[model samples]
Target: MSSTHNQEKLKELLTQYYLNTNEKMVFLNKKGQVIALNEAAEEVFSEDNDYSQMTHAICRRCEGYSNEFDLMSCENCFLEALEVGNGSFQVFMRTKDDKIEPFTASYEVIDKTKEIYAFTLHNVSPQIERQDRRYQRLMMQKTISAQENERKRISRELHDGIVQELINVDVELRLLKYQQDKDELIDNSKRIEGLMSRLIDDVRNLSVELRPSSLDDLGLDAAFRSYFKQFEKNYGMHIVYHTDFSSQRFDSEIETVIYRVVQEAMFNALKYAQVDTVYISLYQGEASIIAEVSDQGIGFKLGDKAKGTGLGLFGMNERAELVNGSVNIDSQVGRGTIVTLEVPITDKR
Candidate 1:
């Protein structure tokens, strides 16, 4: 073939394939009525379409835009508000399946003389679903990591702290068997008895740290009281606590998740906030349970390098999410840090 013929053939193929892809291209008049559309749009929207539906001045399948007030609302509708050429947003639209899904939409006046525009859509719901899946995987991985780390710490504590003391007591008891002095034997026996009491206390403390008995038997209100006393004694720091909550019980899952998140928040403050005192507020809102942990200390900026594993914050957020809740952290360089958690009361049942 001649060179000119080859160029014409290339253009033909380009025209043939360009309009048949996954993208939906729609041409609209000034009235927002669909004037023309590509093969892809036709394939996607043809099943439920009728003659009047096609010709009537209707927004081409657009539902609404997501705003701060609502996820999808006709408030400040895009049809009336799409500017001349600077219109681009995430829009919800009804697809071929008659299901609403999100899409990246762009509107531009392609022909100013006729006041005609081109509206395009690229479905974003698939991408959003993929992102959600990835986040869930990350959450699961981190949860497992946290569990293993806790188990290892507990195992090491048992082997080193209590087990070592027990071994020393065992040696003393065996030596007592060979001792000739009655008073020396009695003294050693009493010493061994003291060691056994301490060992029992250590095991009980470990068990409580793993899962506070008050959390299950009583409620979060009681659990926090017990936890804070131990926290102050163990870390030499005070928690100025206030509560507007009572002893009413919640779903075990909700109570447990909130308890763990609060525990982690306080632990983070103790480890990094560089303060002698922390403030905590627990309350029951109209539809949610809320907790706030605050500290006036040498605060660090967010997105800066974390002093610790950095997974603590993410883990807290993830755990809160599991119970239909949220965790918000606010901090500044020299001011202070506050961690807030909210769980909906709908989950209380």
Candidate 2:
């Protein structure tokens, strides 16, 4: 009798320390009823709540558990599948604040004869969020790389093969003008030459629009200059360009992302902003490259109804994520708009 009493005292003393710890520990019976819980667990779940609500504390908090086939499924519950031993799995639970979130849970049989089990929950929401961001960044990089490579190949084909062929046709049409003395033939030759000239210009413009060779050969600084020249001619809206980034080269992917983001910002301003002029700034920060596009045009509320399909801003953000970068847009109704992109410098300094 003294031995059993001493053992019970020892258990009480040890539980006193465990009950006060930060780790949430809960006990369950074989029927999945809550038997006991530590102080930490009490904060996460209710111990004294009755089954008048047709639920136990564990069932009230637990939404579902993860299995091999499903992210969160209630079909095969962890309580039923859990053997009389140790096991770990992800479980989604409703917290005290009533938010459904993920928790890394472990279950084990604490007393085999009594069929009592221990269940512990460690919140893993933050870790899952970080992991998701990492995966998105990686996927964005690969997708952009593939797109740029294909664009480069198609651009070269149009500029070299198709443009050259069209130019030769222009020369032939011009030669036909002098070869014929008949008024009818001369008129036909003149019209054909005019058509060929326009066609050649269109092809050249399309090639450059697809992918500028200057971007590949010279770098972002030169490429932006060339693109802006075309931009001004096409839109008649001037861009007051400012740059601290000279001919400095970066990784091809970074350059592409920057150029594409800047290009989209300008187009968004042109399409929506009721202004004729925009300001673009490109520079290198401590260990990052930054670009800003601003305009004193008619800006709209950020969360107001979108002017277009709403995919333009989304695409810019997705592109920035490729380099572990970010895009921030600031705008206010009746004021102006500013879009900024910042990407870290990785190699190719």
For every candidate in turn, the CA RMSD to the true structure comes to 4.5, 14.9
Cα deviation at 63, candidate 2, in Å, is 21
Candidate 1 residues 1-349, lDDT tens each?
8999999999999677657667877777876667777777764456347522454333556677765445665666666666623756787777677788887777787799998877777788879999999988887887788789989999999999989988988898888889889998888889989999988878878888989999999999999998898889889999999998777889999999888888988999888889999999999888899999999988887778877667899878878999889888899877889999999976454
Error of 1 at 340 (Å): 1.6
TM-score of each candidate structure, all chains considered together:
0.80, 0.54
Give the per-residue lDDT digits (tens) of candidate 2, residues 1-349: 6999999999998888677666678877777777667777765676556422333456777888876646755566666666512557888888777789888788888798998888888778899999999978866776687578768977777787677767777777667756646886767776777767767766666767778899999999899998898889888999899998688999999999999999989989999998999999999999999999999999988878777656578779989999999999999888899999999999994
Give me the runs in candidate 1 sitting further than 4 Å from their true place. Answer: 1-18, 47-72, 75-89, 111-115, 124-138, 179-183, 300-309, 347-349
Worst 10 residues of 2 by lDDT: 48-57
Q: Total clashes, candidate 2?
A: 0
What is the TM-score of candidate 1? 0.80
C-alpha lDDT values of all predictions: 0.81, 0.81
